[model samples]
Target: MMRRERLRTSESPDGRKVATWRLVRSGARILRVQDRADASPAYRWPGREPLPLGAPGLVLFDELAPPDLATVREAFPGCLDLWNAVREDFWHALLDTSDLPASGTKG
Candidate 1:
């Protein structure tokens, strides 16, 4: 089946470290990730809609800066792409191996 890897930011200029969890599941599997820290009072709401598949990555900021979509895009290119690519690859592999679906469908 699919193999998942968790990734975190090495460092940020503001000293905030972003944490992410990656899931590699069958194409048929659905995964979701959330950022509880973002929901806390310390962050400025970005008004951005939650990702269609939910956030597969969680980021923790040390301060109350508004959400920077651009910075997020630049910082976690691989992680963002992994959400779909990894899942597709794993799903195909699993399908090739067996008829059963993935057990861990949610992130």
Candidate 2:
């Protein structure tokens, strides 16, 4: 299975943080890091706001499942490379987007 997950984060010039994720394909119960990108943190929670991690090596995702184009678009609207990566790399069979809302709208 291939997973697109947070790898690391960096502080932007303005003191805000930018998170980056990598696409990893795992076969034997192991995850190997692949492609990566830094994107705006626009993923949401129903009632809680996203906060900075209190420690290192912590992980969070906008969606627990494979990220849909809309979710990515919300965070990084003009990123063509990110669009292509989500379109081509993530294995849809491993994803269940039925529980997700339609793309381009808020949760």
lDDT of 2 by residue, 1-107 (tens): 21233242232234333334443343111111112233433223332354464233222444445343455446445454444444443444226455355689655
User: Highest TM-score among the candidates is held by which one?
Assistant: 2
Q: Report the Cα RMSD per candidate.
A: 11.9, 13.6
Which residue runs does candidate 1 get wrong by more than 4 Å? 1-27, 34-79, 99-107
lDDT of 2: 0.37
C-alpha lDDT (0 to 100) for residue 101 of candidate 2: 50
What TM-score do all the candidates reach, one by one? Answer: 0.21, 0.29
Question: Per-residue alpha-carbon lDDT of model 1 for 28-87, expressed as tens digits?
Answer: 222222333344223212343434444333433323232233355454464454444434
- What is the Cα root-mean-square deviation between model 1 and the actual structure? 11.9
Q: Report the error of model 2 at residue 70, Å.
A: 3.2
How much is 43 displaced in model 2, in angstroms? 7.4
Best by lDDT: 2
